[model samples]
Target: QQQVKQSPQSLIVQKGGISIINCAYENTAFDYFPWYQQFPGKGPALLIAIRPDVSEKKEGRFTISFNKSAKQFSLHIMDSQPGDSATYFCASTASNTGKLIFGQGTTLQVKP
Candidate 1:
């Protein structure tokens, strides 16, 4: 079974708008939750991350809201710009093992 599930395979937003993507997991053993952003012809880069202990974390326009009780997490982009358009992925890893399971992906397009 897939440990994680993501919604809205694609999204579109206007410049200065907000872009949101969500993910859910069933594994309570998951301790590390991270989001990655990838651009065309580039490797996925770590965007933001939050542990189960933390409720939320934000970096500039990027924010990750985590719900440990619900076993879900979501990413929000504020004032999304065209340059921010990229494929975002959410992943979880267990502490006992270094195995990371990733969500399918969400392709975001920020229109200028």
Candidate 2:
């Protein structure tokens, strides 16, 4: 089973600041990396993603970066707002099995 380790169980960011969360994977076989965000009482939603072929991917205020050699990745939230406060999760998956291994999770609070 593949495992993912995430840092900073919780984070506090000011509005219009940047929020960063990191994850490291144990298996080299994992090919896809994605970050999910979930609000209170809501299901996790795909925020951004990166594959082995790309070093980084950005969508609006969200960015995800991949380091293939290090088997690690990170999610950055730019111009973070109070609405951005939520629980973030980093996950790894292989193309074949399609099994997602998720990190412990990080709760972010974007203060105004």
Candidate 3:
């Protein structure tokens, strides 16, 4: 129930196009939702996050759409660029533990 599953192991987005990825979880106890962006051989960086209380959250060119009842969430990258061509991970955790359960990882390729 602590697992957060993400899909589309890979994606191709043209420059200036929107890149989308989906994730789902079975645990209702999870309250924190975070998305991480990673480049080759680099650590994941927190791009954006949202709490269960909010239906959506956005930061800069990144946005997260969440559905509490459906136990699902997604990340949308607007105006994608070559720099945005990296792996994206959707994660979640309960209130107590600081540990995050991550998705399988999505490789996004944005052509210039």
Candidate 4:
């Protein structure tokens, strides 16, 4: 109940295509859902996020679709690009805990 597991450890998507990645968590107490985008040798930055009160959130080319009942969430990169090629991580934390638990990570390669 304290972990988030992601799949496809790595992915290859064509430029201008849609890139999708999935993740699952066991803890129902997790209230804040945040997806992070990280470039090589850089710290993860908040790309987009949603709270249990909302079902989905979108920011520019990035979107997060969340399901509270299923304990699952996913990241969708619309019109992916070689420049968008990087690592994506889904993270969560309980309301009061400032610490976030992240998935293993998904390395997305958007080929030009």
Candidate 5:
């Protein structure tokens, strides 16, 4: 139930286009959800996050839409650039244990 499943193992986008990724989880205990972006040979870094209390959150060109009842969430990258190419992972954390469960990554590539 704690597992987060992400789709589209790979994605290709034209520069300045939009990139979208989806994720779902079954764990009701999960209260904190975060998205991380990782570059090759580096660790993942927090991109944006949304809690169950919020339906959506946006930061700059990045946005996260969450549905508590559906146990689903999605990330949208606007004006995607070649530099945005990287592996993105969606993760969930339960309040009690703070244990984080991550979804399989989606590799996004933006063409010039």
Candidate 6:
């Protein structure tokens, strides 16, 4: 199984601050990297993603920083809010495999 290691099982951030979550993968075959956010009693949804060729990708207040050579990636949430409190997961997918190898997940709490 492809293993993706995520750090800081949990995190606490102040509202309007930045929230960061990191992940590392062991498989080089993994091509696509995406971040997912899950709210209480809700299914996870795609937050943002980055391709191996791109070092970084940003969408609104969310950003994904990827390091292809290091097999690592991270999510950055700017101006984090209480609504952003949720379990975030980082995942990798290989081309045409339709399978995602996800990290353990990081639970974030944004304090106002």
- Which candidate leads in TM-score? 5
- Could you tally the backbone clashes for each prediction? 0, 0, 0, 0, 0, 0
**Which candidate model has the greater lDDT, 2 or 6?**
6
For each candidate, give its TM-score against the true structure. Answer: 0.96, 0.96, 0.96, 0.95, 0.97, 0.96
Off by over 4 Å in 6: none
- lDDT by residue for model 5 over 1-112, one digit each (tens)? 7689998899999999999999999989899999999999999999999999999999999999999999999999999999999999999988888478999999999999
Q: Give one digit per residue, the lDDT tens place, for model 2 in 4-109.
A: 9998899999999999999999888899888989999999998887889999899999999889898889999999999999999999998888579999999999
Those runs of model 3 whose alpha carbons end farther than 4 Å from true positions after fitting are none
Error of 6 at 58 (Å): 0.4
lDDT of 2 at 19: 94
Residue 89 error, candidate 3, Å = 0.7
Worst 10 residues of 6 by lDDT: 93-102
Which lDDT tens digits does candidate 4 get at residues 1-112? 8999997799999999999999899999999888888999999998888888888888898888999899999999999989998899998899778799999999999999
Which portions of model 1 show Cα errors greater than 4 Å?
Answer: none
Off by over 4 Å in 2: none
RMSD of every prediction: 1.0, 1.0, 0.8, 0.9, 0.7, 1.0
lDDT winner between candidates 1 and 4: 1
* Model 5 TM-score on a 0 to 1 scale: 0.97
Ranking 2 against 4 by TM-score, winner: 2
Q: What is the C-alpha local distance difference test score of candidate 6?
A: 0.92
lDDT of 6 by residue, 8-82 (tens): 799999999999899999989898998999999999998888889889999999999998888889999999999
Candidate 3 residue-wise lDDT at 7: 91
Alpha-carbon lDDT, every model:
0.92, 0.92, 0.95, 0.91, 0.95, 0.92
Q: Which ten residues in a row have the lowest lDDT in candidate 3?
A: 52-61
| 1-112: candidate 3 lDDT, tens digit per residue | 8888999999998999999999999999999999999999999998999998889898988999999999999999999989999999999999888799999999999999
